[model samples]
Target: MAKTIAVEYRVHDGPDALAHAAAEHFLEQAQKSVAAKGKARIAVSGGSTPKRTFELLANPKEKFLQAMPWEKLELYFVDERTVPPTDKDSNYRMTREAMLDKVPLKPEQVFRIKGELPPEEAAARYESTLRNQFKLEGAEVPRFDVLALGMGDDGHTASIFPHTAGIHELARLVYANQVPQKDTWRVTLTWPVIIQAGEVFFLIGGKDKADPLHRVLQGQYDPETLPSQLIQPKNGKLLFLLDKDAAALLPAPDASGKGKLEIQR
Candidate 1:
């Protein structure tokens, strides 16, 4: 396999519908995995698509959002915006308002980024948290059941922007990215850790995202160019759930590749 794949279109002609569907799919898979193993773990994305998906996921009473076994689930942020939780830009607040506060997942299972601390300290703190849960050393990756990702117009995923030291970080489960123009820093999982996840699903939608999505799917799987390209399951799978616009430029695969769902442009 070339190491990336896509899911059904379920086109709603809008971002909300695709986001809701993707969120529901995530919940469904987690429920089943947890039911069979008594626990489920997730690493989630930070962006508009997942933010919308989180809002829909928060309303468990709704159709697709309903019947989720939250008690058996654990949540993790894929990236943090390097601000305190209450700050308007914090990813934790967005997730809290969207899903965490509404779910019955115990407090300990809901890991939040300590952005209020110094970037290095916050990253170290997050590394300790992950080590305890994954039972892994700082240099090893965690095998989470599912990891949701989002794409940037700049072709970056998580806080891993273009050509930075953050991309080369080998330890400290989290790290500080000192990119200019944007926020001075962000906390994100290293590629080695993220790719080790059992299932890596990227939620890509919107017309603005089409170009980057094409680059990620059809272009080189080069981390220097697109950090997202490096996210691949060591022994599990990778799923790219995209809308029509995002899939427009990708080449299609045949019906025989059972493990991959290639969407014909």
Candidate 2:
């Protein structure tokens, strides 16, 4: 199955600016989806880079609260630690404190993985939740309107760590990925489901991310070695939002100073 990958790169002056750009892009996408479908499904990733963006979305500044159609937005986590939701490390907890608590969504509108459960059971429960909420027909993967992802320094996304089982998964929509190096497990949406999104945004920043971002963009396509490189939306948009620090290692930009936004067919 040959697919064309269109990537858009938008670099900002700093982390705060980068977060603002991401928030604006998210708002545009959410509004578009809600207008077309009466609802928006978004799967968000957890990481320091995304925290600022989530917070910006929740804050009332610039009439953001009024601008966003929160009632029509359903939030889901792309991945979660095996710890309970109350844990500080839990993605759900971070999202709640940063955005969900301030949003206008009902409890039923938020689908969170039960990290307290066994990893496999947690994954199954989340998959079932997706099927029921999205009214997915048999063999139909949940297609999110927006899938916001974070890239790790190792080029991993959504707990699909380098050389992990999650990267190799093709049949399953969700699964528990074990990282023996950390002696822990995490529940994540597998590549099959992720690539079904209408839009996938990789919000990345910081100098530490420079090397991996460069590798994922410029290096060979090796999902097993660099899980982030695996993301290729079959019929959707792939956007990479980077701060200047993260874009520093890429090749020099043209006179317009915009970093490269390559589209590979």
Candidate 3:
């Protein structure tokens, strides 16, 4: 028999519920990790899912933000659409406006992708900056405390779109490439870097993503057909934080000793 995928899940009836739970869960994990390690290094995702999570965290009413150690959290991007920081397409800007502005996270702790520069230059500079900041002399990739990700209907994670040659790049920390269908380019953290995460969360949402999510979770999909399928972490743990609609294609846990899919309100 084929080895089964090990995935823990938390399904919410809607996005707001999921976002609140996810934000709280993320802070708890980040806090605990920081408490033990003295710092939390996280590579965050782009798209509406992260925007919702950040907005939830940025809620001025949340006293928890004041108590947590924001200074100890080093924030990095999982990917950047090629645009200026102020551009609507820029993930760097979205994260800053959503979370960094309200929190007292120090400016130095926010490492942004310089998408304003020429694509090649941006990738090179960002790569060099990552190496220096992490002080990674002998390591293939910097180990991050957490990696938060979002998925598209096409099963693309970050900017790694389906059928793109970038999917085969298992060696670079970041890559500058084109997604032909969309006729756009992006700079993304490759699997080499993402797999080094101590914890990786797939923040998938929307009704459109249901089909591909099933394909990915089952491992029957081709990597070239669904980019997110290639995201099976070699060492890190994976979690799928989903909304109810996105779970439509998934089967129920079987009686044959399949692992339980954990869920909560």
* Winning candidate number (TM-score): 2
- Give the local distance difference test score of model 1: 0.74
Model 3: per-residue Cα lDDT over 1-265, one tens digit each: 3333457766777888778777877888789889999998888988887789898887878755775678789888989988999998899899988888888888899999899998878888888889998887755588788888888888888888988868998667889878899888889888768867888888877899888888777655577888876666655347888887886677653443123442210
Cα lDDT of model 2 by residue, 61-176, tens digit? 75567798988988998999999989999999999999889878899889999999999999999989989988987788999999999998888989899878888888777899
* lDDT assessment of candidate 2: 0.87
RMSD of 3: 4.1
TM-score of 2: 0.95
Worst 10 residues of 1 by lDDT: 256-265
Winner of 1 and 3 under TM-score: 3
Highest lDDT: which candidate?
2
RMSD to the native, candidate 2?
1.7
What TM-score goes with each of the models? 0.87, 0.95, 0.91
CA lDDT scores, all candidates in order: 0.74, 0.87, 0.80
Better model by lDDT: candidate 2 vs candidate 3: 2
- In what order do the candidates fall by lDDT, top score first? 2, 3, 1
After superposing candidate 3, which stretches have Cα over 4 Å from the reference?
1-5, 252-265
For model 3, state the Cα shift of residue 229 in Å: 1.3
